[model samples]
Target: MADLKKTELEERAFETAKTLLAKYQNPHNLKLEENSNLEDCYTILITLLYAEILEETEQLAILSIIDGMKLLDGNR
Candidate 1:
């Protein structure tokens, strides 16, 4: 079965990423800001939540995060 909560969080993170990507122009600064949003946006919030789950505790969660990031990149 699919992990619906994880999927929903991914969507929220993607949306937050979209908004940040639109407002920021520099890649360096964008990454910095995005990192900061971990305290403020769903992107970081969701990842942090998932990161705590035993299933996502593995390093491959990094890949999952990257894939979610691609969704933002592809849309923009």
Candidate 2:
């Protein structure tokens, strides 16, 4: 899905995830602004891919962010 086109919101969420993942070594330190779409994206990502975050898999929390877009897109 690397070549898949991402909407602006998706891109924002992806970037946010990457930034947060990079700033903190542990997922527990990550925080999202509540009651916003960005937070919603993070919620989906965490719910679906928390294990990956906990494992620090591939150093790419962006994967979860991308996958979270699928859930959001499906709802739309």
Candidate 3:
């Protein structure tokens, strides 16, 4: 399989985050800021309502989170 360029990866992350954000009822009408970096965007989304956000993102989020955990665990 071909590797994705940085831009392609970032774009995919942005789209996935946007789709996840849309699932929230968002009483505050929170929006992902254009000026914020990807990490910040993800932080806001995940922190807003952790479990719900994870649930909304579903399989992709689960796999990514597990992968991240493994990386962190290995690094420790």
Candidate 4:
């Protein structure tokens, strides 16, 4: 049950990351190939997130999203 919940949370985080990345990319005119690595996208996302002024909740969410990404990478 716990694992299922964790997986669901991770999926949500991943979706959030994807949505944010798309929004960021569009405004900046950044382009990524179809085969771009997840870790590379994660790095760019984190860097961009840190560049902005975010609330504590928003920061925590991004940290959790990054952790979720790392776990997906089998780093956790």
Candidate 5:
């Protein structure tokens, strides 16, 4: 709802997204934060998105991310 406070929604969504993304990230990868691969960074971004839209359909999120990534790829 548009009436909801921005912080409340963001916090809830971020928490939701993080929980789902946490399922895939390997703890050992945290050892080399600066050298983390793009895949790992993507995972983190997706997790952040998830936490923001915890109740969102995964298909929609995946599709959105795929489209967004394509735009980034084009910049290269």
Candidate 6:
């Protein structure tokens, strides 16, 4: 049961990331140089897009807080 839930969550995250990548990579939205390598562009774009999403969602902030708490506890 837990495994099924984890799998579903993973799938949803993957689909969301794919959608984000497609949106950023849409030729109509993004202009590139003729010599640009699309594969490299995509790799960079996806990393940036995911980081944007994490920041926008405040997930990164929450994770940072959690890590801070762990560090403080460990020092005690």
lDDT of 2 at 57: 60
Candidate 1 structure quality by residue, lDDT tens digits, 1-76: 8643435435555555554445434333334243343223444434444534433333344455566666767999
Give the higher-TM-score candidate: 1 or 6.
Answer: 6
lDDT of 3 by residue, 1-76 (tens): 9764444334544565576677656665657755555565555445554546355446465356445545656999
Top candidate by TM-score: 3
Tens-place lDDT digits, model 6, residues 1-76: 3433323323333444454555554543443333334343444345545555444554443344345445656999
- Each model's number of backbone clashes? 0, 0, 0, 0, 6, 0
Candidate 6 residue pairs in clash (backbone atoms < 3 Å): none
lDDT of 5: 0.48
How much lDDT does each candidate structure score? 0.46, 0.56, 0.56, 0.59, 0.48, 0.44
TM-score of 3: 0.48
lDDT string, candidate 2, 33-62, tens digits: 433456665664564355443445633555
Of models 2 and 3, which has the larger TM-score?
3
Better structure of 1 and 6 per lDDT: 1
Q: Which stretches of candidate 6 lie over 4 Å from their true place?
A: 1-6, 26-46, 50-76
| Candidate 4 Cα errors over 4 Å, as ranges | 1-11, 18-27, 30-44
lDDT of 6 at 4: 32
In model 4, pairs of residues that clash are none
TM-score of each: 0.29, 0.35, 0.48, 0.45, 0.35, 0.30
- Give the CA lDDT, 0 to 100, for residue 9 in model 5: 27
State, as a TM-score between 0 and 1, how close model 1 is to the true structure.
0.29
Q: What is the Å distance of residue 14 in model 1 from its true position?
A: 13
What's the true lDDT of residue 7 in model 5?
38
Please give the distance, in angstroms, between residue 14's alpha carbon in candidate 2 and its true position after superposition: 0.4
lDDT of 5 by residue, 14-55 (tens): 443444556545433422243344455456655445544444
